[model samples]
Target: MTERIWKIGTRGSLLAMTQTRMVQELLAEIGVRSEAVILHTRGDQLKDKPLWKFGGKAVFVTEFEEKILSGEIDMAVHSAKDMPAKTPEGLVIGACLPRENPADVLVVRRGNDFFGGGGKEKRGEKKADPASGPRIGTSSLRREMQLREQFGLENVSPLRGNVPTRLEKLRTGQYDGVILAAAGLARLELDHEPDLVYHSMDAARYLPAAGQGIIAVECRKGGATEALLRHLNDRRTEVELAAERGFMYGIAAGCHEPVAAHAVLGEDGTLRMRVMKYGNGRCRYFSGEAPESRCALLAEELAGQVLAALRPAEEEEDHRTGSRRKDG
Candidate 1:
């Protein structure tokens, strides 16, 4: 009898390859033969433009998802954050590895001052002044908005590239600092660098993208492939991500929406979620907690809170626009 081999499709970046290799090793452990098929996505090829300008996060996963749908690959591995709020009609996230650190990090040049407060006190260093607008590099609208509104980063600049490229630019003095996901840095082991300083942003202060730290294996809706993927699912991660993604989907927002939601499992088997929506130079926050078994409902309730909070502001804006048009 011959062993059946599965094909895993993924973006061809170093980080993507690293993550794919991790999955590959897991499959190998169970005597399942699989090969990684590196696909150069529009997101990878169009490194010059910011993600939103390139038509949002779908650019990163659409090709891979299409490949899966076309049966060119058995499955596609992706950073969960790159997935759209709604899964495409023919496919779904069949499995997800255990979640990693979901917090964002501020990577700054040596001796640069941008963030201030508690972390510095622990280091016995003076807290950096909040008003010193360090030139921060990031393409994420969520990160950019948080930096400008919360941290007073007046010099936010557009930066697009993989981790190594962005770090090199930071090292060469192109940016005073850069924002990156702590999970990716930890996965790449770039969290500890002699040339850079890392600050793990507190989740209470900085909400992460929906499904930010998860590795999702997506596949078509049914059959042997989906069955094979069921073995890879981490139940806890699925529940948590369900809540976070539900918050996103309920609000009809995607990666480009300057919205972030995160869910954390509590010691008592409950789930607590935080959601933030940024607009008009400010942010509205909503939170809810529920039994782990009811995460989906909890997420919907949180989304409702966020939407309710935004109604007044949105209506005000609509009224102002209508009045302006009438005058014109």
Candidate 2:
């Protein structure tokens, strides 16, 4: 009897390739054979603009999804964070690999003293001027908003490119610092680069995007391929991702929205989630817990609370603006 080899669709970037290889290795360990088929996506083509400006995070996965639907590939591997709030009707996330460090890290050129005396100034101490503050580069609106609002970092600019390109920009003084996911640096083994200093942000204070640091394998809803991919699913990760993504969908969040959700599963099977949403010039946060089995309901409950809190403020702003227009 001969074994079957699976065709895996993936993007061509170094990070994408590296993540796909990790998936391949996991599949191989389970006696499954697979090959990577690199697909150039629209996201790769438009590097000059931010992701939100064009079509949100879905741009990166659309081509691979089309390929999967057309049966060109048996399955597609993607960074779970890149997944949009809703999955296409015919497809489903077959597995979520064990998560990496979900925290975002701030990387700065070595010897920079922007943090004042002992790295990071005390909260509420005088803030640096936006014009004079150290330049920090990041493409994520969530990170940029948190940097300015929470960390008092005012000078953040949009930077778009792969991990290496972003780091290169920092190396050449294009930016004094950059915010990057710690998982990428660890996966690429760039966390310990001698010339760069890494400050791991507190996840509670600076929440990560939903599904951050997870690798998701998507396949047609039901078939042999789906059965095979199930072997790679980590139960804890899948549950955590479900809750986080549920929260995202509950809020009707888009790539342009500065939203974040992080869920932690404890040994006792309790699931705790922290979520953040930015709207109408304000940032709102919510936290809740439930049994692992009821994660989805908990996420929905938290999201409802968030929306309820934001609506009154939104209506008040709208009324105030309308009144101002009438006076004018």
Indicate which candidate wins on TM-score.
Answer: 2
lDDT of 2 by residue, 132-244 (tens): 77788998999988887877788889999999999999999999888999999999999999988888888888999999999999999999988888889999999999999
Provide the RMSD of all predictions against the true structure, rounded to 1 decimal: 3.1, 1.9
lDDT of 1 by residue, 116-188 (tens): 4456333223225643446788888888887666665667788988898999999998988888999899888
Worst 10 residues of 1 by lDDT: 118-127
The estimated TM-scores of all candidates read 0.93, 0.95
Top lDDT prediction, candidate number: 2
Model 2: residue 155 alpha-carbon error in angstroms: 0.6
In angstroms, what RMSD does candidate 2 have relative to the true structure?
1.9
